[model samples]
Structure formats: C-alpha cells, structure tokens
Target chain A: MSHIVVGIAEFKFAEPPHKLVTYGLGSCVAITCYAKEAIIGSMAHVLLPHAYSSSHDNEAPGKFADSAVAAMVQQMEIRDIGPSRLIAKIAGGADMFAGQFMGSDRCIGARNILAARKALDKFGIRLVAQDVGGTAGRTVEFATESGLLVVRTLRGEVKQL
Target chain B: MGSTPFLSREQVAAVEEIATIAAGQAGNALSRLLKIPIHIGVPEVANVKLSEVPALFGGLDAPAIGVLVPFQGDIEGNALLLFPEAGITELEEMLFGSSGQAEDDLRLSAFAEIGNILTGSLLTVLSSLSERVVVNLPPFLVQDMAGAILDAILGEVGTLSDEVTTLTFNLTGLEDASLVKSVLIPGSAGIELFLEAAGRLKTGR
Candidate 1:
C-alpha cells in the first residue's frame, strides 16, 4: 500500500490500498471525500474560509473551504463519481492560539469549520463524522479501502471516524 | 512578476538590520532570564514567497511549545518563539533552579515570562527603528505539533499578500542549542508600514 501526502493548500485523490494523510492541522481544516463501494478517496488541507485572491492570482483552490470542497467534488465527477456517491468527513480547525486577538465568531478555526460545513452542504455531499474545533492540533489519515478517517493528536489521543 | 517590486534594496537592508537588532537583544534577554550563557549565531533573514511558508517552519509533525507576542502601533507584527519538548524541561530547571514538578499555570507563566522578555526586546528595537512607539500585547502560549501551531498564524497572513519577511535565530547554551527557534514575521503590510516609517518608501503617503 502506498500513502499520498497532502501538503498545506494541496489536495490529492487516491484508490484502494492507498491512504491520504495531512499533518499538523492547527487552524486549517482537512476534508476527506470517499466513495466507499468504488474504494476511491481524496483529501484536502484547507487553510481559509474563502478564497479572497482573485482568479488572476492563480491561487490553489484547495487552500480555501468553499473552493476546496468545490474542487474536490469536481475531481470526483471527473472520475465518474457522483455527488451522491461521496461521503465527507473533516478534522482539524483547532484554535491553537486560543482566541484572543480574534473573537469567537471571528476565529479562523471556527470560521473554517463553518465554511466547510456550508460547502459540503452546497455540494450535497453527506458528512459522516467530524472532529473539529478545540485548542489542539490534529493529524489525520484516510484509508481509501476501509473508508476510515483516523484522527490523532500530539498527546497520543486517537479517534476513528 | 505582475505586481511591482515588494521592497527596495534599502528597505530590505533596513529589515535585516532591525532583525539583527532583535536577535541580539532577544538572545541577551533569554540568557539573563534562564541564568545560562547563551549564544545567537548569525541571524537568518529571508524575504520569501508566501507559498513557501509551510516549509519555512521545519518539523511539521514534531511536538513543540511556542509563545506568541503581538504588537500594535505604527505597524502590526508578531514574534514567535518555539522550543522542543525537552527544551521545556531545560527551561523549567533553569528557570526555577529545579526540574521538580511545578503547577501547570506556574510553568506556563514562566514560559510566558521568557516570551514577554524576548518579545519586549524585539518590540523595543522595532520601535527604535521606526522612531514610532509600539506596545506589546499579552502573550499567547501554545504547545502542540509544530505545523498545527504555525498554521493558525499562516492562515491569517497567507491571504494578505505574497511576500513575507522572516527572521530566525537560535539560542545556544540551553539543553540543545538548536532546539530553540525564535522568529519574526512582519507581514507584507507591516513591511510597507515599516518602510514608510523609516522614510525608505515614498510611493504612498
């Protein structure tokens, strides 16, 4: 089995016997989309609530919540996977700095989660599970074959979503 | 290539000089507070594209403890200090004269003190350069995977502009000289504000 590493603002798609992983997700959110029966999946490391940079900037679409979900869905469609066939799960979005300079409503972590949820809804992708929002960082792995999202913290805490 | 040059040669030189000042003053403050002889080698300063930010902070998956001191005034910027897990114990031992178990609040405060001193010195030097006063806000202490902690700051600044001025220095004489990482990231706007205050920029007001 091989593992595909998704870097910050990067996204990758994979098939059976392959895993998608992202590390150290502080305020950033990682979204995993999978089609269980087909055993294909993708993951994105999203950094912001929205893409403010104009299209001229040629910025990575996976860097923002709204665009990442849309881009990931476009990838799924390009490979013959329908929106209904996709199941989504998200992790990360922790307030590592603990919300001082920004208010709770304005917190980036909170805003990222909100944007992710709204995007998933927009694409009609059902969200299965999530481990989001806190003061700790998270590293997540998604197994395409098993359709399991494994979330782990630096403190040795692990959860299978 | 589309936008004009981010900074002039003189302004970049100004940034390097101010960073050198910050590194020296922060090193001295840590040495005194920790009660250990400390050394700061040549400061490493860079003006990098924002896309390279994730790689700028090394050891993404590794655990780290950090302190963030935010400053506001003529310019807004931040100073971040990071230590390896073991550096925490070395800090505790050097700080209270023993490694015996201490309350979490006490340990946090002790580390905050280190942040306060180091950040205070950097802020002071920055003020000296701009000839404009700035104030240091309360410090934020965090312990987690290095990437995760930095992502919070990165996410905030990544959208602002494409250029980032980063300055880093290491503090030797601790448990591991290389374990201590101190960085200053004055975002693009902050850089313009700095250049303007220093009379190096004449484009806008």
Candidate 2:
C-alpha cells in the first residue's frame, strides 16, 4: 500500500491499495472523490475557491475549487465513472491565522469550504464526510480501497471521515 | 499565471537587499528586546508559485512556532518569523537565565512580542518605500506544522496572483542558521513598488 502525496494545486488518481495524502492544510481545502463500484478515487488540494480560468481549461485546474471539481469530473468521465456514482469527502479550510487577518481575510477558510461544497454539488457528487474549519492546521489521508478519509490535526487529534 | 516570469533578476536582488536590511534591523531589535547577541544572514528572495511556499520553508508537516504580522496601507504583505524549538528554549533562557519554560500565556506573549518587534522593525525600514505603510495592528502568534501555518496567508495571496514574492532569511544570531527563519510575503502590487523603488534608489532619483 503506497500513499502518494498530492501537493497543493495538484491532483492525482488512485486505484485499490493506493492512498492519497495532503499535508499542512490551513485555508487550503482537500477534496476527495471516490467511486465505490469502480474502486477508484481522485484527490485535489486546492488553494482558492475559483480558478483564474472560468473555462476550467487552464494549465492548473487543480489549484482552485471550481476547476478542481471540474478536472476530477472530467477525468472520471474518461474512466467510465459517472458523476452520480462519485461520493466526495473534504478536509481542511482552517483559519490558521485566527482573527488576526484584516477585512475579508478572516473568512478565507470558510470561503474555500463553501466553494468546495458548491462545486461538488454542481457536479452531482454527494459529500459524505467533512472535517473542516478550525484554528489549527490539518493533514489528510484518503484510502482509495476503503473510501476512508483520515483527517489529523497538528495536535494529534484524528478523525476518520 | 502567464508564461512571463513574475520578477526579473534585478527585481529579485532589489527586494532581497531591502528585505536583508529589514531583517538585519529585526535581529538588532530582537537583540535589544531580549538583551542577547543577534545576527542576520544572507537572505533568499524570489517570486515563486503559491503552492511551493510551504516546501520552500521548513516543510509542511514539521512543527513550528510562527508569528504573523499582516500590514496594509500603500501596499499589503505578511511578515512571518518562524522559530524552532531550540530558538524558543534559548529565548526563554535569555529572559529568565534558565532553560525552564514560562507559563503558557507568558510564553505566548513573549513569542508574540518577538514577532511584534520583528515586524515592527521591518515596517520601520519599509517605511522608506512608502511612508503610508501601517503595521499598527498587533502580530498574531501560532504554533503548528509549518505548512499549515503558511497556507492561510498564501490562500489570501492566491487571490491576487499565481506567483508571490517571498524573502526568506536565517537569523544567524541563533546557534544554527536554521534555528530561526523569517519570511516576507509581499502582495503582487508590493513587488512592483519594490522594483520601482529599487530602480529609483539605484539611480538616486
């Protein structure tokens, strides 16, 4: 069983016995889409809510909420998995700076979370589990075979979402 | 976002010099505040992709004590001082003459104070570029993995551009250069201002 680290602004697909992980998630959100019957999964670690390209045709689609969801859906389409068969789990979007940021800066984490949810909904993927929104950082792991997402906080707290 | 690089060589060097001066002043300020010897080392400044910031610093999963100072006025930016565990211990000893840790609240304040002084000194120097720069707000202190701590700030930067300019330097005054790291993440607009200021300063205009 190998765990591939999906870096920020990047996404990857996995098969059985393979897992995807992302570390040091503060305001950045990690979105995971799993297909149970096909036993395949994809993960994206996105930095913002919207990509610069509304067409989702940019070079780095995995970097934003709307495009990451679109990228994953488009790839899954190639693998013969329909959008309805995809269930999603999301983690991160923590306010690591607390209330220290100025103006709208305070709500960046919440905004990322909302964007991820909205994108998943748009793609008709059911969001089954989520561990998000706090004052600490998190690292997440998704097991492709088990369809299990493990969200671990910096303080050593773990939640299997 | 474009194929064109965000900053040219001259621009990076100009920012590096400006940041080095500020970092040196910060070290001096910390030395005075803590009554200890402090030194500043050469800094690495560049315009880089937003996603690569955590990996460039200590790392994503490593534990760190970070102080974030967010400033706005003519330009917006974030200054972060990251202290390793060893540096924290040395700080405690400098203040109390012992390696023993202080109360949690006091320790947090001390760290926050360190950040305040660092950011304060940085702002003092940066005032040259833009007199309107305001850092009146108190700095925020956080202890967590390095990557997690940076993403919140980087997420904000992501709104402006895919690439951001960061100035990273080591506080050599500590036992090891790696003991204390300071980074300045300037807003997209700040970079242009820095280049323009650098050009002006170079020409003595």
Highest-TM-score candidate: 2
- The TM-score values for the models, in the order shown, are 0.86, 0.89
Top candidate by lDDT: 2
- How much lDDT does each candidate structure score? 0.75, 0.76
Candidate 2's clash total is 0
User: Cα lDDT of model 2 overall?
Assistant: 0.76
Return the interface RMSD of model 2: 2.2
DockQ of predicted candidate 1: 0.60
The residue-by-residue lDDT of candidate 2 on B94-155, one tens digit each, is 66567665776787787788777766765666567644455536777888877777775667
The top-ranked prediction according to DockQ is 2
DockQ of each: 0.60, 0.67
Candidate 1: where is the Cα deviation over 4 Å?
A55-57, A101-106, B1-12, B48-58, B74-77, B84-107, B174-179, B187-193, B197-205
Regions of model 2 farther than 4 Å from truth: A53-57, A101-106, B1-3, B84-100, B131-133, B174-179, B189-193
